[model samples]
Target: MKSWPRPEVPTITTADFQLRLFDTADQVIKPVHMPATGPVGMYVCGITPYDATHLGHGATYLAFDLIHRLLLATGRDVTFVQNITDVDDPLFERAERDNVDWRHLGTSQIDLFRSDMENLRVIPPQHYIGVQESIDDVIDVVQQLLDNGAAYIVDDPAHPDIYARRDATPQFGYESNYDEQTMAEFFAERGGDPTRPGKHDPLDALIWKARREGEPWWDSPFGQGRPGWHIECAAIARRFLGSTFAIQGGGSDLIFPHHEYSAAHIEAACNEPRMAGHYVHTGMISLDGVKMSKSLGNLVFVSKLTEQGARPSAIRLAVYASHYRQNRDFSTAVLAQAESRLDTWMQAVRRADDDSAARTLIDTVIKHLAEDLDTPGAIAAVDSWAAGIVGAKDASNASTELTGPGALVAQALDALMGITL
Candidate 1:
C-alpha cells in the first residue's frame, strides 16, 4: 500500500472576509499571516469608565467576543486584550459632577463594566488592562515619540499637552483616509480661537495631557499628568500584544481622531508599518429608529434593558441578526423577532434526534458562516433547513434529521449568536 500524504491545513484569507468601517473605506483586515503570526492577537478598544455600560457597548463587545470565539474554534490560540480608559477627561467631569473621588469613580465603573460583561456572558479579555495600571507604558511610548521627533511638548500652565508631530509623518491621515491638504484647507478656512491652550494645529492630538485640579495623575517624563485618550489604547495594546497584531476592533466613532492618532503614535513609537493588521469597527446601535447615544438622550442602559425584560441572549441576537457593520435599530419589536427566531431553532433542536437532517442543516449554516461570518445569511440558512424539515415528505427521515444534525444545528447557531439552549 502507498503511504498517505499529510492533509494540509486550511488557511484563512481576506477574500470575502467580513470587515466593518474602520477609519476608511479601503482599510481592510485579513487573517494573520507570516509576519503577523500569532494566536490571533486582538485588542478591542474598551469602555471609558464613567457611566454604566449601555446596549451599544453590549452589541459591540458581544460582536468581538463572537469573533474571538470563532478564531479560537478555528485553531488559533487567541490573546485578547481590552483597555479601560479609566482616567480620561470625561472621568474627571463625571467625578466632579457626582462629587466623588476620581479613583473611586474609576473603581466603581470598572466594577460595573465587569458586572455588565458577566451579565451579558461576554467573555472577559485575557488581559483587562486599565489606563491607571499602565501609566509607565504610556509614558514610555510618549518618550519614544519625543526622542524620534514625532512628538513635541507644549508648555501652557493651564492645560499642557504633548502633541504628536503631524509634520514628521506624511502618513498622519493614512488610517483616517483624510487628505492632509484638504484638512489644512478646511482648518484654515474655519479658524477658531487662536490662543486656546494646546490648540496649535487643528489636526494635532495629545499624547500626554496635564492633569486638571482634582484629576488623576502620575509622575511621568512629560510631567505630573495622565495619558491622552488615544495613547492609553496604543500603550496598552503594545504592552499586551506585540507592536503588530492581528486585528483592532472598536466602535465606528473611534475611527478618526482616536484610532487614527493611535496608529500614528504606534508607528512613531514602534517604528513599525502597522500597529494592527486590520481595524474592525462596528456600527452604532439605535433606539426607535434613531441612534442610541447619551448625547441624544436616547441611550438604553444595559441595566435598564434588563429591567425592561430583555434577556441578554435576545439582545445579542437582535444586534447580530443584522450585519455588525450595519446600523442596528434597537426596539422591543426587534428583540421579539430575535426571541421568536431563537425559539424556532430551539424547538427544531429539541425535535431533532438523528444525523442526516441535522447534519444537512448544520453543514449549510456553517458554509454560510464561513462566507465572511455572514450571520444573517447563516440565520436564513437555519430557517430554511427548519422549514424543510417541517415540510419533509417522509416522516421517518424528518425524525432522523431531528435526532442528528438538527440538534447540532441548534448548538452551532447558539454558539454563533451567544444564544443559550
Candidate 2:
C-alpha cells in the first residue's frame, strides 16, 4: 500500500490538562501526549452494517467520538480512520436471509448508519474505508506476511485458508490480557474456529480464506479469496495511518483474537515492534444483565429509539454518563435519567451568569474529561453548577449575572459533549 501524506500536528495551547488513557497492552493508565509534527492518528473499528445500530454500537462509537472531540478541543489536528466491514460473513448471511444482494444491503445499512451518527451529533471519521474496496491492499499485506514467513497456507481438505502463525509474533496476545482458557472461550464467542483440525495452533488466526461457493471472492496473489476479518483492519490502518498510529480502538469484545491478531499482522508486515501507540477498548453494553446480541434478540436499536421520539442528545448523554471503560446496562430508566440531567443542564445554561461559579464549573468539567475521560465526573460538575445557578436565581435578583455563564455552559456542552442546547 502507498503511504499517505501525514497532517501536521499543531501546537496545543490548552492548559496542561494531561489526558490519561488506559493502554490495554501495558494494562495501565498513561498520559497521552500529542505528537509534535503530525496529526494524532486514530483508527477505530467501525460496524459491519448488517444489524441495526444498537446501544452497543452507539456506546463504542460515542466513546471514540469523545476522544476525537477532546483532541481537537486541545488544539491538535486529528486524522481519524474508521473501517466498515462491508464484506464480512455476517453481512453476507444477513443479506441471504433478507433475500437481497449483499452489496445492496451493505449500501443501505451504511446510509442508515450515517444517518444515526449524524442524528446523534457524532463526528464522522476522515477516512471510512470498506473492506471490499481495499481488497488489493489487504492482499498486499497478506502476501507480505507470507513472504516474511509470518503466515502460512493451511490447506485442509475441509477448510483451505491462510493462517497467521501465532508463535511467529511474540506480541500476539499483548493487548488481550487473557489466559489460555479465557482466550479460548471468548475467541469462540467472537467467531474463532478454535477446534478446526488443520490450524497449526488453537490461537492461529485466519489471514485469508479461500473463496467458497456463493461467497464473494476477489482475485489476489493467494488466488480467488477474500481477506480475513483481522487482516482487513491491518491493511486499512497501514494504508491510512502507516505502520504505527497513535491509537487503535474498538469494543472490549474485540480485545481477544481480533485486536490481538490485527496487531500481530501489522507488525509482521511492517517489521515494526509496535502497531499502535495505544490500544483502547470501550466497555460493552448489556440489557437485564445479559450482553446485548443479535442472536439473543435483546438489542436496543438507536433507530427505534429515535423513531419513537427519544432525543438524540438524551441517548448520547445516557452513554456518556458512565465511564467509557465500564459496563453499562441499557434500560429506559437510564435514558430517562439522562434526559432529566440533560434538561437540567439546558435550563442552567439558559440562566447562566458570567460569574466565577460558571467558569469554575467549566474548568472542573474539562479537568474531569481530561483525566481519562471521566464523563460521569464532568456531568456531576455540570449538575452541581446548575443547582447552584438555580439556587442563586431563586434567592435573589441574579438574572443579570447569568447571561455570560449561560452562553459559556452552552458552548462547553456543544464543544465537549456534542450536546447543543
Candidate 3:
C-alpha cells in the first residue's frame, strides 16, 4: 500500500482564493468548503491494476493533483486517501486469460502505475490502500450493514451474496438522481447483476460475493467471500475519512452504480446523511473519437508514451490544454502541440528575464484554478505570458532584466500547476 514519491511543490505567499468544484449531485460548480476545524479529507478511487496506466488514467489523477495543489496553497491541511481494488473480478479474469498468477499480475501492474505517477511528478496520496490489506475492515463494514438491516444475504447454492437494501438508506437514489428504470439500466451495464435471484429490489448492489472455486476469499460471519466492488470503497473511505469527507472523485463513468452504491452503503453503516461534501468526476480521454478503455484494447499507455521519447512534462501540458470536465482526444498531433508549448515555456524561463508581468501571471493561474480547476484557461494564461516574455526579449536591447519575474514564474508553475517548467 505504499505510495510513490511526491514532487516538491513551491510555497506561494498568496492565499486569497475560493476553491470551487462541480458537485455531481447539485449539478453546478460551487465552493467545496469554507475554513473548517479539521483537516480536509479526500478519497479518490484508485485503479484496479489489471493493465498499465493509460491516458484516461493519467487525466483523472492529474486533475486531482491540481485540486491537491490549490488546496495546499490556500492554507488547508488535506488528508487524501485512495484505494486499489486488487481483489476485483477484472484482475481475476485478466489473470486467467493471460495464464498468470493473479497476485503477480496485480503487483506488476501496481508497480507500473506507481512508475507512471512518479514520472508525471504527481503528488501521491497519503493513504494508498489495497483490498488485500484491508480485508478485515471490509468485513466489519459488511457485518455492520447486515446487522443494521441495511443489507440482506441471498442464498445462492454455490456461493451466498449480500446486497444493499433500498429501504434502509433514505438517500439511496439522491446521489445519481436517476429514475428507477435508468438506474437499473446503468446498474446492469456497469457490473450489477440486476436480474439475479434475490429478495430485495433489483437495484440492490452486491457488497459480499461468497467464495467461488479458485477465487480469493476471507473469513467473515457473512461467508468466506471477497468484498464487493462498491463496498470496498465504502469501507476504505470510512476507515480513513470517517462518515463524511470533502470530495469523492473518479472518472465520469463511475457516477452510476459504483459511486451511488458506495455512498448508500456508508450512509447506512455510519448512520450519516451523505458520503462527502462534493462528488466530482473528471472527463474521459478518447482516441480517434472513441473513448479509450482496457476492454477495447484501445488504451494509450503513459509508460509507452514516455518510453518512446515523450517528455512527461509535455504529456502533462497536453492534458492541461483541456478542461477536466470535457472529453479530450489523444493523438500524436495533440502531443506535438503540447511539446511546442513546453518548448516556448522553457525558452521563456531559460532567458530568466525581468518582466513585471510575472506576479500577474501567478495570480491569474491561482484564480483560474480555484474556479473549477480551470486548467485550459490557466495554461492559456501561461502561454500568453511566455509569449510576451519571449517577444520582449527578442525586440529589446540586452538590458538587465529583473530577477523576480524568472524566479516567480518557475516557482509558480511548480507550486500551482505541478509543471516543473
Candidate 4:
C-alpha cells in the first residue's frame, strides 16, 4: 500500500543536533546514534484500521513524524515502514457487526485513515504494507521458527495452531520490565488470551491461528489459517528492513506482549539477540478524563475535527502541546489554546521588525526537540519569541513571503514539527 503524499516542508539550514530519546526498556533518556550518511530504519506500528483516526492515533503517529522530520533535516536517508493491521480480529468483528464484507470494510477504513494522515501532514511510510499482501512472508518466518525449534504446533479440532516458544529466546521478558502478574494483566487486557489451555506456557504468544468456521485463512504448512498478531510485524520488518533496524516504535500500550513477542520471534528465527537498536513508544491520549478507546465509543476523531473546520495546523499544535511521552487530555479548551497560539505565531511572522530573536528561536526549538522530543519546551520557546516580537512592534509587515528571520523560523517549524502556519 502506498502512503499519502509528503507535506510541503520548507527547506531550512539547520545545524546538526544530537537527537535524544527515552528508551522504554532503559527507563532513561539517551542520545541516539546515527550513521554518517545512510538510511535510518524505523518501523512504527500502524493502526488496525477497524475504526477511525482519533486524537490518540494522531498523537502516536505525530510522535514518530517528529523523529522522521528531524532525521531528514539532519541529513539521514530514512527507510520508514509502517504496517496496517488490516486482517486483525477487531476488523473482522467490526465487519461482522456492521454486516459488511470484511475486505470492503478494511479498505474503506484504510482509505479514511489515509485521508486523516494527509490532513494532519503526517510523513507517510516508505513501505505501508498490509498483512494480506505479506502472507507469504509471514509463512516464511513461521516456518523458520519451526525449523529452528523455536516454534511448536498445537493439535486442535480441525487444524493445528502454531505458537512461538517463550523460552526460545533469552531476552523474552526484557521489552517491558513489568512483573509476570502485571504482564499477564496487560496481555489479557490488550487482545491477548492467557487462559487458553492448549499452550505450553500461558505467556507463550500465538504465531499462527488455525482457521475457524467463519474466519479468514491462508495456505501454509502449519495450517490453513491466518498470521497471528506478533508474527505480522516481525515478518514485515524483517522483509523490508533486514534483520535489525534503528528504532521500533509504537504506543506505550504495545510495550508488553506485542513488542516483546515481535522481538522474540525475530530473535528466534534470525539467530540475533536484538531486533531494534532503540525501542521508543508514545504516550496514551485521553478525551476529557477518560482514555480514548473504540470499545468505550468515546473517540475524538481527526476527521470529525477537520470536518468541523478546525485548522490542521491547530490540531497539530494541540497534540504537540504536551510532550510525546506525557499522557494528556484533549478538550475543547485545549484546541482553543492551540488555535490562539497558531494565530500569535502567524502574527509574529508578519511583523515589520526583523529581529535576531528569530535566529535564537530556531536554535532553541532544535535544541528542545533534540532533548527527547521536548515539543512542549519547543512550543514554549516559540511562544516566548512570538510574544517578544509581537509586543515590540505595532506596525506589521504586509508581505507574507517566507524570506526573513521570521520566515526562517516558520520554515523550520514546518520542516521539523510538521506544523505549517
Candidate 3, 1-421: lDDT as tens digits = 8999988888988758989999998898999874358788899999998876989999999999888888888888889999998999889999999999999999999999999999999999999999999899889989999898998888777767888886687777877788889988998889988788965788888888988889988888767888889999999999998988899999988999899989988999989998888999988999878889777889999999999989988998889898998898888999999999988887777665555677788889888999999888899898898887777676343324424567788788888878876
| lDDT at residue 404 of model 4 (Cα atoms) | 73
Error of 3 at 257 (Å): 0.9
Q: Candidate 4 on 1-421: residue-level lDDT in tens? A: 8889987877778777888898887788887767555799999999888776888888899899999999888878899999999898989899989999999998888999999999999989999999999999999999999999999887667667888898999878887878889888988988787777678888888889998888888988766899999999999999999888889999999998899889999989999988887899988998887898877988999999999989989999999999898888899999999999998898888772564778778899999999899999999999998888777877544356656777787888999998876
Q: Which residue runs does candidate 2 get wrong by more than 4 Å? A: 1-14, 156-159, 394-403
Give the runs in model 1 whose Cα sits over 4 Å from its true position.
1-37, 157-159, 180-200, 390-403
RMSD of 4: 1.3
Among the numbered candidates, top lDDT falls to: 4
Mark the regions of model 3 whose C-alpha exceeds 4 Å error after superposition: 352-355, 395-403
Global Cα lDDT for candidate 2: 0.83
Q: How do the residues 1-421 of candidate 1 rate in per-residue lDDT, one tens digit apiece? A: 1111211222322122332223342455243442345577888998887776888888889778777756654555788888887777677788888998987998877777777777677766788888878989999999999898888877676677787766556667776576767555543333212234665566676778777776667897667888877788889888888788777888877776677777778887888776776777888989999988666888877877777787777777787788877788888888899788776665566565557666666666555555445678877877776555555534443342333455466566555455665
lDDT by residue (tens digit), candidate 2, 1-421: 1112322222222464667788998998887757888899999998898874888999998888888878887777899998999888899889999999999998888887887887888878889899878998999999998999988888675456998888877766777778889888987888787887788888788888888999988887777888889999999999999999889999998888889888889998888888888899999998877889888999998999999988988998899888999998878888899889887777777777656776777778888888888999998888888887666675344343335768777676677777766
How far in Å is the alpha carbon of 277 misplaced in model 4? 1.3
Q: What is the C-alpha RMSD of each candidate to the true structure, in Å?
A: 7.4, 3.8, 2.0, 1.3
Clash counts per candidate, in order, are 11, 6, 1, 0
Q: Estimated TM-score per prediction?
A: 0.85, 0.93, 0.96, 0.97
Model 2 lDDT, residue 223, Cα = 76
As for TM-score, the candidate ahead, 2 or 3, is: 3
